[model samples]
Target chain A: MMDAWDDYSEKVMDHYENPRNVGIVEKANGTGVVGNPACGDVMKLTIRVENDIIVDAKFKTFGCGAAIATSSMVTEMVKGKSLADALEISNRGVMEALGGLPKVKRHCSVLAEEALKAAIADYEKNRRDISPAA
Target chain B: MNLIYMDHHATTPLDAEVLAAMMPALTSEYGNPSSNTHAYGHAARYMVDSARAQVAQLVGAPRPDDIIFTSGATEADNLALKGIAHAKDYMPARNIVTLAIEHKAVLDAARRLQKENVEIRFAAIDPYGVVDLDDLAAKIDKNTILISIQTANSEIGTIQPIREIGVIAKKHGVPFHTDAVQALGRYEIDVMRDHIDMLSISAHKMYGPKGIGALYVRRGLKLTPIIDGGGHERNMRSGTLNVPGIVGLGKAAEIAKRDLKSESERLLKLRNRLEDGILRRIEHVRINGHPTNRLPNNLNVAFAYVEGESLILACRGVALSSGSACTSTSLQSSYVLKAINVPDFLAHGSLRFGLGKSNSEEHVDIVLDLLEKGVRRLREMSPLYDMAKEGVSIESAHFSRHARGK
Candidate 1:
């Protein structure tokens, strides 16, 4: 029924409609993609690292309203924070910032956290590989 | 903005004529049909009789007395299946067979019967959501006491090859039952001609009031009473008659019979226009059900790279269901779609649009426009869409497993 929308918070709906930072970060230091096809949602997180701090964060997510909204919220939460602070962005925090997601869609929040951590891991991998050359 | 309702498969708005027909029963004509000696009771009895006749006419039942009113299709289905299952409890036939895509009423009833030691066999459905005739034939052996299938699936709107199924059941000397809840008003049905021995239908699906349904059993069929009470509905079902709901159902049935021929054509025209417009506008979309044999009032499509929930929420001012009514609330992708071999990702993106008599070409256009924009907006933000655009296969990308603690 149309009332199914009531299950989602207004903030969640907003990010789904007008999601911020929706494209890939070209020539990025690291990109993290997390999600199984079985889950019906996959998230890709991109980060620009400068002086050990995330200067910009962007995401492209293929998923439900909660998944997309959570991805957008995670991007907004991590920008202007150090890698450690960004890593501290928990799934519960992302859900809280978006008001809340339904019980069934709470995994979208977990996907957001997992994707962010995966991106940071990729950045560290890049740093480890390039520091020897520098 | 006024929302345009397109999810008629879930339920419909009560028609004005049905409301008018039901109003007297609810108020001034409020009398127990059982107390037939009194004037008030006589009036109520007459209304109930007329309603029974009207509904019988709608389904071409040989006798109105064969119709037993229940709470809804769920109850009707439970009564038809469980009643027959328990009635033949001592017989050698200990198994029942039904389609994988049947409504929860039949499925759950059969499941309960299974728990009580009745072997339940679920016939597989083809990728198009049609019950595989070969699989069905193999499942219905001499031990299979009853075979139940839906005339039209509520989720995908795929109409079954019911006549052939009925003939098979007849050939095997088994009683064939169909959950015709979705097909009652949309298609013409004749119990005898179709070889259907028992059938179920609900009122709300046909623009009648909710909480009222009927089960039609062929004459001379032996059945045990499910709801035992004061001997109402020929002792098969016993309860106070729902006079208002029955009246509304009768009026709806009468109107449906009169309008079905022309209404189906109109709905077909509207549905095709909606489907064609969305297909032309959207980039990676697939219609879920049978292209030609689907219900005229139904359109189900899966939009690539768009999540089912987000797409529905994004398309404001148009009412739709991401899945069928029964399973829509669950986060799980549609089981019907899964049974039909729709990939999990595409299954999650599917939406069902059920056009009703209330819809028009203008409404169709508006819905198509909204759907196109909504899918685009969501896909734009989708990483999977991005990968898909770059010729990446999403299924191949996610073969790795994850280990996360924080």
Candidate 2:
């Protein structure tokens, strides 16, 4: 009955329907939150790193369907990957993961990529602060 | 199953009688109304004239020739604003005064004129979108040539005191043009009686076919033509007459005029039921426009802390507009709400439900139930609600705090 699901690849639909790592991580070592008051779409990303790897990543997005799906895809892509590899995850990569979004909804995926980059940047800043010699 | 349609402010279904009246024009009797010396033209002209009479009767115009046909309200608006702006006597120094809450057709036209060195002044509206009469009066000067205001706002459904505003424009000896697109046929409008110099009306708004509209230019008011062509619409707008569309419009006007009283009463009851049902069932909801001074078929409410898009998605069975149908495609906040000082948080959560010919008590009940459920669910997950419950005002949260440089 929901044949429209076929437009999306199996992987994209899986992430959209059963999103992974969905929610906020409280008082985390690294957090990135981006908000667009205009469209009322907001994204908050939290990361926990052990060694040089992204040990855990999670996200919460308050937006339309594309936005929520994009954030979910971001979390799934970043998981089990090194912090540098996760930081390299691009908006174009997210779009490719989800087939594609309507032109108007492309902003949603772009926001997810920005949120992930911000989180990685925050983690690097924290590491630099902790290391007295730089 | 009983179906309900709440998009009356959008194009309405053609009345059966209107369709009957328009059949002849769409069938064999079609002819160019401008063509002379032919039986076809005579019949076509008769239908056109009859439709004009029907429209004139509804508006209480003293004569039928005062009405000029164009495409719908958007075209009418463009013609009135640009026509007046380009009149040879029109001075660039003369500012155009209009309210902030006007339809974009008018607002964007004014913006275009401003680019051509026409000074445009936007009068402020109160939080409820009612133009401040004092602020409007203060903005008028000898250099002000024209003022355009919508008779009723399409978004909030708030009715401006156009008659009062018309009096003010007359006092200042400036021409007043109203975008009566939303108010025509629903309300009584007479160019002379209302002291209006020019008015814009759309056919599709009152169950007429799309691509047909009319503008009321008071007789003897000389304005330059916006469309340069074969001297159509008394040279104000030049284009081939859309005979079929005009026939639909005329038939719609006739039916709307005949049924105005009873239909208005019925719409008011349905609208009130919808408003009361939702308010009684839902918490933290506020009506957007003035209660008494609004369209009988409109009920706009701000569902505090609930995302409007989510609520719409949840209630997919009923098709209704959030704000302007145009802006809904874009995920941006409603400019009308932002203009009237609806805080960003509440503005994003606002919903517009326009009642029309098809809504009923049962439909209202269904909507109310769905809305109650939708609002409760969405608000439960909203962080804004959590902040509000903790006694943190959104304004204080913004103005009192700045992110510490980390």
Candidate 3:
């Protein structure tokens, strides 16, 4: 009988209802996908990087409300940040930024964090390939 | 906010007539039924007896005395499973046969009996969540004390062939018990014709008050008391009677019996409309439960690439339930869906819509619109959906294997 929205914070619900930077980031740079369909959560993150700084970040996520909210929050947190700074954004940071999720939903934040880190890792790998002496 | 109550399988609002019937017990008619010395006691006893007869009539029990009131269906189910299994006469037969998709009330109690060295065999369910009668009969043997199966599943709404299962139990001379909480008023259940030894039902599921249910024990069936107290209800269950709840249950039963035929047809139509609309509007959806033999009021569906909880939340004005792992505290999807061989990814997206007396064509249309929009929006944000659109095989994706080893 509990309302499905009762456990969510306003900020979480806000991001879930109006996600930031949704969809793939054009044809440039790196894409990181984490989680999986079987567990009911999969997050795909894409970043458009320029001069080692993430200028654009977007996400495509298949998950619960918390998962979507966390994905949205993490993308906003990484936008305009350097690759190193974006990598420092942890799962706890995403949760805190969204005013914390339910205890059971904390894993969703972890997925967001993982997706962001993987995207940065992908960008670094692509950069290394492009200029070997950089 | 007028939220559509589509989660009737969880519980129902109390009927007006049931509340009216219960008001007397809650107010001035509050006297102990056992205290036979006073006029107040006589009045209380008369009301209790009448309510008992009403409940007995609803289920077609031969005698009013056959019904033993309990706290709710959970207690009734526990008593039917444990009380019968632990009975001195049946102790020698230490095995029980039940379906894999029974409610936790029956399954958990059977599990506890397992710790006491009682062998429990779970009969398999087919893709539509129907019990395989052949598998059930094969599991029953000379050592089987009881064959317990649900009349209908709450999650998927698949109505079992209870009469056939009864015949199987009778052939093997095993006591047949059914947790009929979901099917009590929705389907025609006659204990005599079905050869049912015990059946559990709850009032709340039938639009009565909560905290009142009964276990119908066939004449001459012996069951050990689970709650040993003042030797009430023929010494099988002991406690002070919940007079108000009992009156509510009795009135609810009477109303259900009177309207069962018409209400079922109405619900079936609304359910079909909802089902048909969702199928027409949504893409890559799969319906759960038996297509024909399911409860008239239940419709469960799995929307691929969209998680169940997210959809339920997105359709905010409608009340619903999900079989997804994210909805449960344990993070495990519905065992009933799992037993029916629904893939893990699909199971995570399963939603149960339980239509009730309040649902109408307008409500169904509203729900369909909300669902279409919700599924579309959620799928838009889905990575798997994108992959599927691009011709990637989601089944071979094996998404769980890459769950960071969680």
- Best-to-worst order by DockQ is 3, 1, 2
State the lDDT of candidate 1 residue by residue for B1-406, as single tens digits. Answer: 5888889999999999999999999999999999978999999999999999999999989899988888889999999888888889887658888877889899899989888789989888877888888999999877888999999999889999999999999999999999999987788888988999999989999999999999998888777888898989988899999999999989999999999999999999999999999888888999998888889999899888777877877777778888521225555678788888888878778899999989999999888888888887788787777778799897677533432221
Which residue pairs collide, candidate 2?
A: B71-B213
Q: How many clashes show up per model?
A: 2, 1, 0
lDDT of 2 at B214: 90
What's model 1's lDDT at A126? Answer: 92
Q: What DockQ results for candidate 2?
A: 0.20
Q: Could you tell me the interface RMSD of model 1?
A: 4.4
Q: What TM-score, over all chains together, does every model reach?
A: 0.96, 0.87, 0.97
Lowest-lDDT window of 10 residues in candidate 3 chain B?
Answer: B397-406
Please give the RMSD of candidate 2 to the true structure.
4.1
The runs of at least 3 residues in candidate 1 whose Cα sits more than 4 Å from the true structure, single-residue gaps closed, are: A1-5, B324-327, B399-406
Q: Where does model 2 exceed 4 Å of error?
A: A1-22, A25-29, A47-58, A120-134, B1-4, B88-92, B323-331, B393-406
Clashing residue pairs found in predicted model 3: none
* Worst 10-residue lDDT window, candidate 2 chain B: B397-406
| Candidate 3 residue-wise lDDT, B214-267, digit = tens | 999998888999999999899999998898988888898899889999999999
| Tens-digit per-residue lDDT, B45-122, candidate 2 | 888888788777777777788788988888888888888888834463868899888888999988998887888898
